[model samples]
Target chain A: AQSVTQLDSHVSVSEGTPVLLRCNYSSSYSPSLFWYVQHPNKGLQLLLKYTSAATLVKGINGFEAEFKKSETSFHLTKPSAHMSDAAEYFCVVSALNYGGATNKLIFGTGTLLAVQP
Target chain B: EPEVTQTPSHQVTQMGQEVILRCVPISNHLYFYWYRQILGQKVEFLVSFYNNEISEKSEIFDDQFSVERPDGSNFTLKIRSTKLEDSAMYFCASRGQFFQETQYFGPGTRLLVL
Candidate 1:
């Protein structure tokens, strides 16, 4: 049973300030982790994914996440928060299907980020 | 920059009515998937399709649900009957043939069962 837990349901930050959205996972084996963002009325957009590669993964829109094996964490971070950064973020874990050919993503509850101008 | 596309950005239907949500995945992609998010709930996987057949499905994908790749371009999810609980945003995604290929998502169709 693989799952992800988002530490915060909502986070507020001022523009130009740093942002952090925490996530932790429980998996029996090495996991593929991902971060996705959803704007209001929009589709889920991929941020970044960790597939046994470098621990630090950079994504679009100036966001990044570090996969910490010891802590079982993959928290998203941004150097500065912009109004456009406001969105709901989800931490996802890929559960491999038969033959490891395809994966079904297990998602977290989500963390709503509010950027204040 | 090929992207997945979905039709009927929004749909409203009466209870017990059947509805089909359509998607056109990236032309060269081999894997297609359907997921749904009820209001305030996490997105959930419904089914995954490959080689024109269902490769995997979640518990939420009951007998009333079916998926098909009718032609070279269209992949559809048909729900036999609509219930109030069915109202949610449905997303279609596709991944390339290579291993560990990233899945690209389309703008979802928001379904409302009245």
Candidate 2:
């Protein structure tokens, strides 16, 4: 049973301010964590992924997230927010099947971020 | 970089009618997958395909759903009967062989069951 919980359903931030979207997970094994962003009327784009290589992972468009094993959390952050950063974000965990292959992605309910100009 | 692509960006269908959603995965990728997100709901996995067969499927993938890679490049998801609950944004994804961890997704097809 693998699950991801995004703490906030909606987050409003001012332009040029810092941004944080909290996410926690429950996994039976070492999980592959990912952060994806869905722009309005657009497809999902992978922001970052953590697969035991590095605790701190950098992603596209000035986004990054840290995998905290102790906290069971992978929270997305940005030093400064732009008007374009407003979108829906999802925390995903990959589950490996019996054949030792990554099967499906369990996604969080998602947090919608709104940037105010 | 190559990416997955899906057809019929929007589709409106009557209940009980069959609908086939099409996808064209990355040229060299070996794995294909289908996922759906109901309005304001979490994206859920429907099925995964590899080696010309289904490798795994979720509980949400019931009898009404079927997948096929009829050609070398096309992968399709067919719903035998449409339901109001089936209205959602369906996404198609594909992953390469070596970097099996990352799955690139398509723009998605918005299906509206009336």
On DockQ, the leading prediction is: 1
Cα lDDT tens digits for candidate 2, A3-100:
99999999999999999999999998888899999999899999999998889999998999999989999999999999999999999998878774
Off by over 4 Å in 1: none
Error of 1 at B61 (Å): 0.8
Instruction: List the lowest-lDDT window of 10 residues for candidate 2 chain B.
Output: B94-103
DockQ, computed on Cα atoms, for candidate 2? 0.70
How far residue A17's Cα lies from its native spot in candidate 2, in Å, is: 0.3
Tens digits of per-residue lDDT, candidate 1, B8-97, equal 999999999999999999999999999999999999999999998898899989988999998889999999998899999999999999
Compute the lDDT of residue A40 as modeled in candidate 2.
90
For model 1, residues A18-96, the per-residue Cα lDDT tens digits are 9999999999999999999999988889999999999999999999999999999999999999999999999999887
* lDDT of each candidate versus the true structure: 0.94, 0.93
